[model samples]
Target: MPLFRSPTRCIPVALSVTLSLAVLSTTVAAQGVRTADPRASLKGGVKDAQQAIKHLELVSSTPKVEGWFNPRDLGDFGFANSDLAFQKHLVFQGGWHGWQAWDISDPKAPKRRAAVVCQGGQGDPSVYGNLLFVSVEDGGGRLDCGTQGVSDTVSAARFMGVRIFDISNLDAPKQIAAVQTCRGSHTHTLVTDPKDKANVYVYVQGTGGVRSPNELAGCVRSPDDTSTALFRIEVIKVPLASPQDAKVVNMPRIFADASGKVAGLWKGGDHGRGTQNSDRTDQCHDITAYPDIGLAAGACSGNGILLDISNPANPKRIDEVIDPNFAYWHSATFSNDGQTVLFTDEWGGGTQARCRATDKPEWGADAIFTLDVNRKLKPAGSYKLPAAQGSTENCVAHNGSLIPVPGRDIMAQAWYQGGISVFDFTNPAKPQEIAYFDRGPIDPSRITLAGFWSVYWYNGHLIGSEIARGLDIFTLQPSEFLSKNEIDAAKLITRDELNAQLQTKIVWPAHFSVARAYVDQLQRDKGLSESRISAVRGALDAAEQSSGGPRRTALTALATSLVQDVAASGDAVKVRLLSGVVRELAK
Candidate 1:
């Protein structure tokens, strides 16, 4: 079975129910969508478990081309525009300050057209119109690694901020401006104001790292000194058409309570958890903005915050949700209707950083939560991934988005190793899985030769990003398309004939059906290849006791032997089974 529901964590994502169902309505007036308005309140409760929506659909999965991406890690995903049907390109930064853009117009077989390499760490890419913002930070932005110590240089370059690029040219994107706001820029988001004539705003935020050597001396800070950046969310306004009008403003004050402390309630105290004034720094990771509503959502380290950016220069936060369970809230996305917001956790760091000795959860430290935003942001319900119970240390939900379905009540999301899942959210509290595709276990010979990292829809096709592998493309069969031609009943085969002629290569619309096909064929085909199977089983048994397993080498030879047996008997079923397992192991 596919991994769907996730484990529980400490947090809330939306509004309380006393307000009425109007809060969940998708109606929009001149002001904008009702529930989305910063002034309007969001009200709703977790859906009941018994109300699980039914008939989830799985279009297809193509694991043959997984080796294309060939990278160690994958970060955020950005589309050309909020309404574009296909992604224009994708950018990622890590290991080496690096960036690459692909012509994803062909989502399944995207080609890398251009790449920019940097030395320090480069994070997510934010795009607006023709301009792109790439975050860069190098120990104070200096080019001196030999002279000053590496740590000191990195701390000094707190000069980290966004690097601007002019992507007017699809083939050759040029760098138009590199703006530095505050000390460092960790992640930035691009916003466009529909009310204002084609105007854009860039919110460049920083992860408060150690600034000075004194603070680095001991991981402790003087509580009286309010310089710890852990609580600040900076805003830098940049005109989309005019680059010269750029200006930086401190916007964290909007979310700051009367005492000047961020509304977020901290847990684990200041010792291990970094406080703004403490020697360590806090992380304000990813933020998503809905310009039409003058609302922006932030996935802070341990909390989720909502800000009102109606006054571009002076923003105000109307509500917030905190989860002490998740070590850090990493990414978030709003439903197309804007009534619900989905949040995910980056739990890997908590187990390693805090040094908790308890066994981790099976799907590891990842979970998905839904929030209601009518009156104020409040928690609606939550779900966990990987049905198994133990901690999933590495495989986590890094970044995900909800597919826009015009009138449906279900939602779809992608997990790194968990593949993609489409769920029915009519019962928001107990969201049940309708469809899923796990990459299965890691196999060297599988398509791109890596784990599935990112999945998005482009040009009506499902595009998957497999780091250290290539892209895997899939789409609904021609017969599944809504506009497909209707077939006559006379051409269809009977159930008995279909069962008798069942073949391994027959493509199915769902994963469970696909699994059943393979399992059934395996049982039927085993009877006809008893001698051949016995030989391979003998080799596998012997290899298990050998010093270095020769199972793969033996498997290839066995597959070659089966090919001959199939050829002599004209048995395609045995050939397909032997070939798939052999290809996976031999590679």
Candidate 2:
């Protein structure tokens, strides 16, 4: 996760009267209003035919050299409409190394103002006040939360959990204090209570770390430890001056009801480990707090969790939502109105969870879902990426925002191959794509490989984290046409129905033996042992056993070869394999 970027980041300013005069000058120039001017007319009203919304404007794109941690998420303070002297900056995790800040005052051009490198570099980041609290997944390679194969030689500095940085100064953000309290910090959010200043708190969710040898049966001291009960979401009250005041609070005692029996503890410590309301199911990946609602939502890997933080010192776990469809929830954000919670699944990047190829976007298993906290954390709706574009090895919408753009109804989302998409979620159940900017020259087929990590609307400007590149900024060009039917009928269909339709539409070529030969050569050349090679061969055989066996097998072989090629030779694989592992698994 050590990407080519820096860390921790934000700001305010004014020459008093001079700033006021400058703001007045700009406002007077903009015809007296602060917001972007509305279009004059809707020339062609809504019609029976669907109108295409086109993408306009490429503000700026920077190619990151020594990338920071993988840019996991992005956020803006008041850079949109306010006349803050130095517009708010963008705060993101530089891969796993630390936090990186960028100055985006000029929408057309952005400057990388600062980078804050800290220990335990991997995890999601969130900003509050002048402090940037990052939930670092640094457990000293001690826990096997899932990355069992990650090299043990990576330093502990890369695994220190919850490194607090003082980002008050934009130029040289300092790591004032470091806390190794949790086993591993997945993601944390700062909860600021306007009602009581003493109530401000930080919630850090630690997805259970590497299981101990005693816990995981038949497992040695490897990374894949499932038995360790270290997974928990912590509520620590913070003092304005020192992070040392951070202390864990008591959580609702939740226990795992395995087979109707109280078997284990909830994942989030006393919240119940191996039980019905266990927050530790897949490990807490994100903790989003809406202080306005006195609520803190945890995006557990396989489940969604909600907690009432009215009493920050001792939070209460109220309800939990579990959807088996998505197994890995990466990030969570509340809507502007603070009624709806949005969760993004990080499933499409060619891992076991999302095994699709890049071009075949159907297999790209990422999804955008909303839960209504106002109604007891009930799931309000969900919208998955349409499967018509084929499957992608690693494409899916990642960290995004419910933009405040008037009449746009667009939620700016970071799609790997899709680049950045502004979708009309006017109808929450069905989202319409209004505009999209695909990353230049990147294989669209491999859409889940962390191409664009985060996308957020900062005022009029749309900021995106292009993982392969650096930060990208864009301006939304208002479109005159209104598309009523951008929502595909296919997307509304049930998974079974979609699969039924795909059975006929997802056909492969009659012959791919030539490509198969090349794959064999590669396996041999790579010196894969007989057993490992057989494992691959077994995959091909297993795929071949499905309905579209021949096609699926050939596609699997091709994709496997392609991924191996890309990993080994750094060559782009342009192959599409919708009917491969994804379709086969669906069957």
Residue 536 miss distance in model 2 (angstroms): 67
Q: How do the residues 109-180 of candidate 2 rate in per-residue lDDT, one tens digit apiece?
A: 666677654434344565555665666554442222233324544333333356566667877676655555
* Candidate 1 segments whose C-alpha is farther than 4 A from its true place: 1-97, 137-159, 181-183, 208-224, 262-264, 267-282, 350-374, 389-393, 440-452, 476-587
lDDT of 1 by residue, 395-420 (tens): 45455444322222334454444445
Query: Given candidate 1, what's the lDDT at residue 192?
Result: 59
Q: What is the C-alpha lDDT of each candidate?
A: 0.42, 0.43
RMSD per prediction, one decimal?
A: 20.9, 25.7
- How many collisions per candidate? 53, 63
